[model samples]
Target: MQNKKRLMRVLGGGALYAATFFFDFDNEILNIAMFLLGYFIIGGDIVWKAVKNILRGQVFDENFLMFIATIGAFAIGDYEEAVGVMLFFQVGELFQSYAVDQSRKSIAGLMDIRPDYANLRRGSEIVKVDPDEVMVGDEIIVKTGEKIPLDAIVIEGESMVDTSSLTGESVPREVTVGSELLSGCVNINGVLTARVTKEFGDSTVSKILDLVENASNKKSNSENFITKFARYYTPGVVILAVLLAVVPPLMYSDQEFTKWLVRALTFLVISCPCALVISIPLSFFGGIGGASKLGVLVKGSNYLEALAQTEIVVFDKTGTLTKGVFNVQEIHSEVMSREELIELTAYAENYSNHPISLSLKRAYGKAIDNAAITNVKELPGHGVQAFVHGKEVLAGNYKLMKKMKIAYFKGEIMGTVVHVAVGGEYVGYIVIADEIKNDAAIAIQDLKTEKVKQTVMLTGDSKSIGEHVAKKLGLDKAYTELLPADKVEKLEELFAKKTEKGKLVFVGDGVNDAPVLARADIGIAMGGVGSDAAIEAADVVIMTDEPSKIATAIRASKKTLSIVKQNIVFALGVKGIVLVLGAMGIANMWTAVFADVGVSVIAILNAMRVLNTQSIHNSTVPAWEGNVEALSNA
Candidate 1:
């Protein structure tokens, strides 16, 4: 409660006790003195401020109205009534302050993610320095357990990087020599030597910080409405109070002039716009915070409002719905065991730079202990050859198998095909493909559950590949063979069909999907670090690559919109009833108290619910890939 309100309450109670002193003076003086002290503490400053502002030609404030009502009560010798009115008015101010702070706390947490220092490297020696001092082309040493200070690539060492803080992906990505790593990722293990490509403030993390800090400058619909409402509401109430004070006495006689004026003062006290001004913003703040906890970062409240209106969710196929990497899955062997085929493939693949080689290595556990190896050779975009365990090994596409006279059997070859040979004799084959993100299915299902009218996937992959993944996840539509530009075309077609009331949300990764991201009503970027295009185009970013965060963000939006509606109804409904009573002179201090503090408490409790999305989903792994390291203990 406001200090003003508490003081008034104590004074009012003391005056009530002093009313018993009218017939007895034995202890009445003490009660009267207590009542006087309470009155001065609560109303004296308000009265003084009103007089100063009136002299300064600003006479429409609540302080001005409060003084008039309390002084009228004093003229009528209703000491307790005067003090009670002051107490309740102050209570409303206290409640408004508490509500606004709670809302600010939500956004404040997101601001905290901005870091203050970067570890710099100087002449083979590592040093701690301010981020602004960082320069381009400088070698920076970001060790295990440290935030990447600038955008750079790994010059040496390997480790699993937990990018969930930036990309929303719970998985730890492996970084080796030549692999690019962005700022803000916590290096989990292994010393990383990075040569900075971008300076400190010019880096990816810096851009994100800059964007978020300025997000509120771009107002959403809801914020604009409250701003306009309060600007008008404050002045309108002041005008009504003036009419109430002057017109009531002129229109009716025989009633005390001070009595009608006191009623007008009470009306002014209950007419504060603080509840609307404070609670509406709180709703959005809580919603944003709630989404962040689920790994979804909303750049601004405008996006939060846009999300609630979303009816269609259009997803980019690669890195959005499906796992972006191609990996080996099944092996068809004629004579050699599956293990032997993969062993031969991995051994020969060690000499190749093709993605097929990487997939084979991943399938073979990347640990070929076989010593009997020699004559290693590789053909780019074709295959690999080597002598593994004293036997000839040839692993490539169907071209190698056809050259060696091998039979091809078909059964679910969704991924790349790697044919194997023992002593140049065709023995087996391996298939590799990019797998779907684990939570894609859950993300689609929850979208439908949340009243999302349509779910679609657009990809540059073949129709067969798109359909196979879509069927498994139950997407409503699939658009395959789309170039990055083609994606924008498709999004426009979808947008043309829907009204502004319903939105089209596009979920994508870095630069590859920026056009579609910008075209959609709400652009969501998955794995946002270093992808300047993604950060620039997207309004909401799932720092991790978790598809489930899309759903978490939607859920938070729905809940926040719901809370805002509840507060609007609550504050307006109570005030509506109280206003009628105050106008008819039937309402008193109790009604004013409820209008201020009671409504504020309800709105505050409703706003805090933005801390959670209320729905959680399970994790998924592809059919063939094995043992993905999700996160390092950090």
Candidate 2:
């Protein structure tokens, strides 16, 4: 629809410009003929819409103003001026179409993330099916080289998965049985059996699609202000133009009415309200486009603007600070050998579904031949009880050790303490700690480098664990033992601490973090493994679960803000010069066209520069200048 509207406008402008030359030969007849053609080609629709709006009691609009201005110009036989007005206004329309198309292209990049269909394996039958048709718990076979259809669990087989499109990482990750696979990740090699865990509509890819498609609904702050400015600016200019035509001639007793009336025509031509109107929205559209190219999906221009104001960034500990993959770092024991302890611990934890259990089993150094295992029982909310080789083995917390009639003397423990009771005697605890995200420290340092004033972490983890993670990351502060509501309180405190010009942003990726994520000034979610609650609540959704993207997002936001300011300054500067020239009766129609169309083109081109995500990390605020003035005096 937009393209078609743009086509008529372009054709109308070209024809009107050409009609001038052919009619220039016969002044009287030519002028009338050209004005008629120009009026019907451009102002006809405006006139119809104005009349229709009047009947509907929605009378005030740009179209009504345009219709009145052109007709008034033609009534005095100023055919050239009337055509020029139509021609330049149409040019502005074309410029707007181009900007809108550029925005659409940027939005299209995000739409590419949604999947079209899936390959389903039902017994011996392999049929092509829509991802929406696949049900939860249905076994879906993902072949080597195909994108995973939906969020699902690996039921069988193992393979290296390529999730660079989803996560920004270049390396392929190995996934085995019981691993949950999200949509948009491609299987690198090996056949894998997956059980669907989420429906297609609720998949991460789907939400991303919905976000991209509906992004335009939420107007950026700049766009909103421009819309309001245009509204008042248009009517104000029209009223002034009417005063110029009527009052000026009446006040000057001997003045020629045509001279003052000509000035009014020039005023109408200059007052098209296209540059500020087009450039502002174009700037936001370009920023949105550019950010998406870097795998950052900004919900609206408002979020982009909000991102630019961020001074404090809060993070969640488990998934956002760390990788959320627990690993058995070190095991301390006096009676058992390293190999014996790991074996017994793995044997005892075989039946548990906890993440720590899997980490211990992985550290066991040997695959569990399930057929050799004997009795296995699970105790919810605590740990697991199992018998290995007629030994009463217990693997749980300190409470579980006491429950099993074993005494556990508290020991100095750094990592998570997984208490063990082998043969009804308290053995030693395995130290299980969630591995920290490699980019955590660098991400924090990068945020500071990007002018982040305060970096904080909120977590439900113990203080010792939170402090250790925050210390490793070099963040400014850390808060621990936070429930969902507690995280919200911490966010509110961060908000209160910020300067009036600053904003507080929170990053979380768990079910417990959802409420705080929603309550934050800006929330960032690691879409992978992040609960639906977190994703739905977050303002900015990072498709990948990488901490580096936080820095990337900040870099993109600051860059976008720079471009937006540049566009606004350039557009207003050009229009201000032209508006002055128009009022003085020195500006020609060609100059007005250049101001309306040429300035818009430059501003739009500048806005498109935001799409280049490369070299985003290369730019810095040049801190040398800040401290160098003191050095010179010294």
Candidate 3:
């Protein structure tokens, strides 16, 4: 409704101004009244704002510039120039507002993931209530096509959940009993009853919304420079215009005061700085909105700027380049049978909850008698030491065997090796290996195609396993057998190796990786729905857990920065040439209006190109080769 009213006023004032050129009124009073009506109709709000700002001692703004320049034109009997300047300025403002609205719609689409209400189970009946009113541990029923209101664990039903809004993956994930469901996913095709694990305030959707809403407060260096430039540029130009009007006519006897004053008015109209002030930040805003559509959330524009300068990308082994889930692959026994070796190893690691230990228990497939196991001690950075069947058993790495003075044979296997010792003597070892993610090899290839100089992997796994995965993925370097603290030290070394202007990006998905993630120049967290520590520590969050999105993010950042540079160069270059011409009396007020308002509209249109994410993503990745055998082997 407000837009309609403003549009009507602009059209009405524009029609009155156009009529003055076609029809001449015989009476001077009538001609002056028509000019006054059009000028005040188009620029009355600007004049009122200028007065208000002057009273509050906040006078040097766009409104003040337009008010003084147009009123000075009217004082010199250039009534048509006065009305045209204000009319074109309003048209430029409408275009800027429309461009900003379009950018905001992209962000508002993501905000639609917030659920309106939850269906809480009460006794024998289900009642609808606000999501915030539902407490933790309450059972919630999600019907088909309803948004899951809270993070929960499925307890009684099977279904498929659409996770596109949260993860940007189009395929629906199958969920059964014991499967974890995150908030903001839509339950599809089944009735599911889940026990809520978190309250509304701590849910996944709330955190994402909070992160996006506060993102604009953290500005980039370019944005800060433009802001400070505008702060001083307006007042400096006003002072220069005062000198161009007063000092030039007084110094030269032949110079007319009115002609010099007209040039000064044209200069004020040209030096608004609206083009630089609006389009630079809009470019970054569109870039962030574009990234969200690809399931990559940048917490601020500063991180986006750093991502564009990335030269080295470091990846974590587990849950980043490869699936973190472990599987038992091979077992070698020295003296005891394979069955006996497996039974003793499982018993020694019974009390542990590591992925390797769990894989051993799963392979054993039998419950151990906890009464027989005694004196279980866990040794960090090595392995576990426990007494099984009245004999001391050791299940750990080669370091543990060397510490106990037990001679062990090393196996040439491309996996993590768990060495076993019985009564201080070498027995056997088990090989546990993790499968690489389907997109892991392609993700590395895509990074290289994007011109990333170095791709490195850091892992706590054995040297053989690390080198195998790194070689398979075609990484530049691989460092293995690193502890949590050792990972930080290695990162510091890599940091010094980079060029002075180049940046290093670290990607991780575990709690142990928080230190290295924080230490890098840009930290990216994978699987934001799963790890709170990763989300808290990372500057960028990949919601889908796909390493390919890293390439997508870098592509988007480079495009956004490219647009920003284009706007800065175009706006300044045009204004510089036109300002010189206006001062030399070669250009008029009409040319000044085009220099200020027309350039702003064009730059805003250019900035809006960042919101086209389909084009960005399509350009980032190449067409997939249909070689299934090669992909699986990789």
Candidate of highest TM-score: 3
What TM-score does structure 3 among the candidates reach?
0.88
For model 2, the superposed segments whose C-alpha errors exceed 4 Å read 1-27, 38-66, 119-130, 137-149, 153-165, 168-179, 185-195, 365-387, 391-411, 419-429, 527-530, 615-634
lDDT at 497 for candidate 3? 81
lDDT of 1 by residue, 1-634 (tens): 4545554554664465455446454665665665566677656667789899999987755576577667766666776777766766665555555656656765565444455677777877778888788888888787778888788988888998877666545779999999998877778988898888988777877886786667666666877898898777867987897798788678878666777776676677677655666777778877776666566778888898888888889998878877678776677887978887787778877766677677788878856664667888776556777888778887787776666676655555665677777765668778777767766777787788778899999999878778877777789999998899888888888987777699999998857887778778888988545667666778988766767677778777877888888888888888878877887789875676567666777777777766654543232323323223111100
The local distance difference test score of each candidate is 0.73, 0.74, 0.87
Report how far off residue 93 is in candidate 2 (Å).
Answer: 3.2
Top-down TM-score ranking: 3, 2, 1
> Deviation in angstroms for 426 in model 2?
6.2
Weakest 10 consecutive residues of candidate 2 by summed lDDT: 625-634
Candidate 3 Cα misplacement greater than 4 A, ranges:
19-23, 331-352, 361-410, 418-430, 618-634
The residue-by-residue lDDT of candidate 3 on 519-573, one tens digit each, is 9999999856766776678999998888888999999999999999999999999
Stretches of candidate 1 exceeding 4 Å from the true structure? 1-84, 118-128, 136-198, 202-208, 331-357, 360-412, 418-429, 496-500, 528-532, 612-634
Q: Please give the lDDT score for candidate 1.
A: 0.73
